[model samples]
Target: MGASFEQRPQPWVTNISIDDIHSRDFLAISKIHGRWGGFETLEKWVCGAYAGYTAVCLRDSEGKLWVGESRHDNEQGAGATEVQYSNGDNAIFVLFLSLRGEDVIAVLPWDEWWEFELNKDDSNPHIALLPLHPDMRAKFNETAAWKYAQSMNGKPYGYHNMLFSWIGTINANYPPLLDAHVVASVMTVCNQMQPAYAANMWNEALNKRLGTEVPSYSICNCLAWDLPDLIVKTEMRGSSFAELLTIPEQDDWVYSDGRSASCVAFVLEIYKAARLFDPISRSIQVTEFTIKDAYSLRFFENNSSRLPKWCNDGDDVEFLFCQIRGRYRMELPGYNTMDPYPHMNEMCPSLPPKYSRPSNCLKAFPMM
Candidate 1:
């Protein structure tokens, strides 16, 4: 299966390292929730979003389990996140690859995913919501957990419920299959932020009815509103921004006409401090932008920033090297600028007037 994507398997193939998936008592899961086996629908969420293989599990000849991941590299738990070979005798680096004909059963451990770091600032702070397994069982199966599994092996691509069932299965699965726990966590990561949010809103409403901020109970303790209820920004599936762009037939009817549409993001900058409630408080934000109020649109960069795999090594620049297509252009604002200012470069977008500038656009936008 690994051979197909690259025309051949490299296992003949670089034997850089070896990891035994079975012998480890505990396999730390990196992304209790992530896509596995290259499902097309999951492509945009992780791959382009900068989420690579979440965790790599390997067993050593010493009968020990070692795990590592590409989710986030440095400054996490011990403030040290990547796995480096400390001793060659008990180390292995496993790379997750997409191989043709591999029905890879992606196991998501939802519970642990809740434990993922909660960060919001860097363009892709969602990484905090991902999970990683601990070297210790912390607590064994004693009403604490069980080894459960869910399979979409033969289900339709968008059965939808298959994903939910997968989450429940992960929660039900315990330590016997530490891998199962990791799988369950991965499934948890897969759960859209919906159920968590819906459950919270009502629970909070109930709490408010009681007239107190105390005594709060969360059906899903993993839900984090601070992360932003982004799903509400637009529809969950299909062409990225078609839902945002299309109105009911009474409005535009273009989407109803059935022609596939893609998103053209106009990434302007907004300067503010990064705070939990407002994302603007202590720090002076330099990058800000103002969008002209036409186009009935907002900007999200037709493309995502290409983050460097090694954060400290710093190869990829995460600015307006952005993605764009079809009539979008970038420009510097001027007093009484034309309705559609001329685009300065292929990467720059011409101003649209659908959106009124949100203040401090110059500080928010990167200067071309």
Candidate 2:
């Protein structure tokens, strides 16, 4: 029910140097095409197309991965940020925050996220403040950027709703205009870096390599390979056996129509992309994969790996999963709403210690 791409031999697979760690030439573009709806509408049609949604994840000078979505969320809706932070269940820090949740673009910081805000200004309307560890706030002034950020309290957060079809000298009340433009431009450039191939070609290759019965859910899994490779092209996310799923797209992990997980698909995807010659067959095996023994196929092994816990205090995916899957709902650590940020919120203690304390695990005292 959408546009299709052609599959061609990605000859560039041979050109990539697995040993080259610092090469900036290798860019990863993950096109998340889902049913968001509105690709082709007439008469002042807003770009809010459910035709699909796209997100381009790129790394910055600081080594932080910035994921920028194509569309902006509601001004009052907390869903995007809720999903972004996931109340600290997902190990990501929301670099961009605003009253309206205008953070179409979010930065997943390498270091722990602490509390701070660099208020809105003319150039950037969305608020830049976020929760940081209390101890780090004082040392924040040490940086020139921090000093300037703190000073941005008074400027108006300008916004402009931009569309490629439309031309303008329109006023700048639409802050998304700037945000969307920057993200779109960067995605365009990243996309251009890839060898010219139809989108369906990539999808077909991905499905064939993974032996996936359903490629739609598995396509999102490529982000596991795409993001980490772009981060350090030399290494894969987990390894040949395991990989890290950094982006927690609801479609891939949560929602499903009884599809198998996509871990083995990642192994094959990376194996072919890196152009490794199979020793036994002595040919580059991209389309076909075989194993000598059944014991070797442990599909569930490292597949449980997720980016990091980042659920918002109130937005409980566990509850939602239960409602949808019709399973018993499991309560996660308690939400310390009092904490400035959801990440800082303490997890309620488990009845008995099984493993090391859970993230932000609360210290429960014996009955007094």
Off by over 4 Å in 1: 1-5, 8-13, 18-35, 38-51, 56-65, 68-368
Model 1 TM-score is: 0.19
| Candidate 2: regions farther than 4 A off | 1-4, 8-37, 40-62, 69-94, 98-103, 109-159, 164-368
Worst 10 residues of 1 by lDDT: 265-274
| TM-scores, all models, native as reference | 0.19, 0.19
Residue 54 in candidate 2, Cα distance off native in Å: 6.6
lDDT of residue 137 for candidate 1: 20
What is the C-alpha local distance difference test score of each model?
A: 0.21, 0.22
Please give the lDDT score for candidate 2: 0.22
Q: How much is 131 displaced in model 2, in angstroms? A: 33
- 107-224 in candidate 1: lDDT tens per residue? 2222222234322212221121111112112221211111100111111121211111111111221223333335324434544456554333222222222222232354554533
Instruction: Report the lDDT tens digits of candidate 2 across residue range 259-305.
Output: 11121122222222322222221222211111100011111112112
